[model samples]
Target: MTEQRFREFKMPDVGEGLTEAEILKWYVKPGDTVTDGQVVCEVETAKAAVELPIPYDGVVHELRFPEGTTVDVGQVIISVDVAPGSGPVEAAAAPAPAPAAEPASEAAEPEGRQPVLVGYGVAQSSTKRRARKGAEVPVQEPAPAGTYYASPAAAIQGELNGHAPVAAPAAPVAPAGGARPLAKPPVRKLAKDLGVDLATVTPSGPDGIITREDVHAAVAAVSAPVAAPAPVSRETTPVAQAPVQATPVAGARETRIPVKGVRKATAAAMVGSAFTAPHVTEFVTVDVTRTMKLVEDLKSDKDMQGLRVNPLLLIAKALLVAIKRNPDVNASWDDAAQEIVLKHYVNLGIAAATPRGLIVPNIKDAHDKTLPQLAASLGELVSTAREGKTTPAAMQGGTVTITNVGVFGVDTGTPILNPGESAILAVGAIKPTPWVHKGKVKPRQVMTLALSFDHRLVDGELGSKVLADVAAILEQPKRLITWA
Candidate 1:
């Protein structure tokens, strides 16, 4: 019987100085056999969650970590036991030709330095292609006289052939020189799906990389402007080409969606928040007539023209002012570390309903901004959220949140707490209703405010006081100056 060996798979630093990652999910188990290129786990980096594809085929000997554990890059997460006389150990040794059939050379190596995964081991400065099998003639495409293949594969092949890959002889270059315009990965995918040639289309991405908009523009450019189809007489009528249709692959009936961008980030965040934090919720409703009128006045003011003045803006401003007054709401409860984090500066999160899902991107240092500055920041946040371009920075370190369910015409809802923040304020719709105003029964614009907080940090009195203060500010905008 041949001897068997185990290989430890350490997580690679998948670019950026990402120190640690949260294991969002695990796709493989201790008993499951996995092949190269199969997804073994999905991990959440600081910016996004990516599915980690396996780099070797082997039986799972052990799982070093479980889901939800924070793992440092380059730490061993799993071990795989390779079958005796398997391709794995040989291919791993193949890169070091001296080690092949030389037990003496392997015995001299250090204990922890042996290569693991075959074909791809510890990266090397120099590379050589594996010799191909069977009888075959060398195939080469003529380079454009002075140009050569700069790809690593071709260069390595050239080195193995005992000659450096040389540039082709020069010729007069045409405008395009048979070179296709560059496009982004997404744009290239779009062009392939739309049957458009990127080389013939104009580019709009930075430095002439094709954008999705560019392809749409190209499609528009190629289409002839229709004049009403001239009356088709029987003599001149011709047979029409059948419209091409995409066929669904057998056994594939579901829509496939890319999970890279916001969707992935949101999922990771929600999961982290739900699982990590202990949540407690509370609610309150207030008549916000004065704040509603203040919005109208701000809209009509000459100083605030050409600006989007909305009630949510005032709610955000009020929330910031209230946070300054009650510092406890602008905090995070860190249970693991046995500490409470209190932030002096407010990272006010606005939970906006985007086409993708709920994204709570925040305004940094919101408490420092003046009314107009806050309004401008709120405007940008809303517009960016709607366009689905909210950056990761805008989504972190939220000291408090305001979810304007009012926009959806909702009266009240117990919103889930944002991941790190201690409090989330749900602002409901303002409608004209009967109310007591100036000692008289009259119609007034009224709205409900629901404040949800982590009870572990915020007590009933503290939460109620914070809720009442916000209601007082909205009920009388003049009261904000005094209460804040």
Candidate 2:
């Protein structure tokens, strides 16, 4: 019988500077057969909860940690055995040279073939995380000339001995005492930022110095800014400066939040895409009155009742249908392999603006879904993003994307193409506007469709044709018969 080795899989730091993660639930247990791309577990980091997909396909041999336990990164989570006749199977043993055993207590060898932990694992020194740039560190300083400082250990010793650590009495004051000089510029700036005044902050640095950190602590104590002194009776006052009412400095009052998460990811992707890929955007305004009439007709249809049918949904469907005609639009450029991957399935991404940040969660294989299914998927995607529950997996593997800025009451704007995708469609507001319908001026529900594609992959002619076809389907819903 061929010996089977189990591969141990460890939990990786997915993102968001995760230190420890709580295992929400496990999708598989011992003896369960699992495939690659299957959701193995859901874990909650500090920022949000994410469903983790497995990268290897095997039968579950054992699980190391149970659900709800907070596991550190690089900890073994699961073990899967290599099937018989799977080839390249090795018996479990220590790969490194082991010293002559002296019967030291050590962890038992795992029962079955466990995955050899590689990559970021094994090296304890490499796992040490440095603090981020803006993180604050504590400061330690000596006591003043007349005051005495006691170490925490000494204080504890005194407490045990029935005496508490106390400051020594100050020396007698010298004659002709003068006010101490004020804090320095950096210390004053720190105080300003912390909302502490130089006069109020205690000097803790050497020689009765007021360090920047002391001012910072004083400012932090007063978390919220103190309200301005109530204005004196303006009716009775007629002074030259009017008492110089204290007003917060304009720019100084603004709060600065660091860019992170989706915002940070979006910025990095956009810059890489904008500069690397030569973007060519083409726009076309279409009279969508017919589409509006169809929407109104469907609103009363019994089959579509209780569904949140909207113009954006129709536009999304139209774009999907057009993608079938021009495959170049739904493709990716693999610079490394010098290949253009034409995707048959559509991972349709919808750009949604939520409270946290802008997120584009794609509907996997959207082209294969029915109208109702697509609508429900769209609804769920929007709701998940709104609740900040959209997983990172749902936001990836998108072949093409659509940004519906019309929801924000904006007419039209150029949208950045999502990285890895060749093209992105921007759906504008469908509003009543004067149109040239059959050579006559009339108000109609018109909309502008802007298609931004990578010029290298999709040419002007192909892009225009795709956009025109989508518009045609919207202009006359009956045309979808041929397109679909």
Q: Rate the local accuracy (lDDT) of all candidates.
A: 0.59, 0.61
The sequence of per-residue lDDT tens digits that candidate 2 reaches over residues 105-183 is 2343222322234311121111112222344212222222223222212222222111122365443342233332244
Give residue 33's error in model 1 in angstroms: 45
Best by TM-score: 2
| Error of model 1, residue 61, in angstroms | 40
Evaluate model 2: give its lDDT. Answer: 0.61
RMSD of each: 16.9, 19.7
TM-score of each: 0.53, 0.56
Off by over 4 Å in 1: 1-253, 353-358, 384-389, 434-442
Encode model 1's per-residue lDDT on 1-484: one tens digit a residue: 1333566777766535667665544455554577887777656555534557777787665555544345678766766666633543321211121111222233343333443333123322233322222212243322222232232122222222312334533433322633335653334434443435556676677876777677767766867221221221221011111111122233555423334334566778778876766666666667777787788888888878777777777777777777777888778887789898878888888776543346677888998887888878887886565444455567777788887666545788877788878889887777899988779999888888888888777888888878888787887788767766
Identify the leading candidate in terms of lDDT: 2
Q: After superposition, how far is residue 406 of candidate 1 from its true place, in Å?
A: 2.6
Residue-pair clashes per candidate: 5, 9
* True lDDT of residue 340, candidate 2: 83
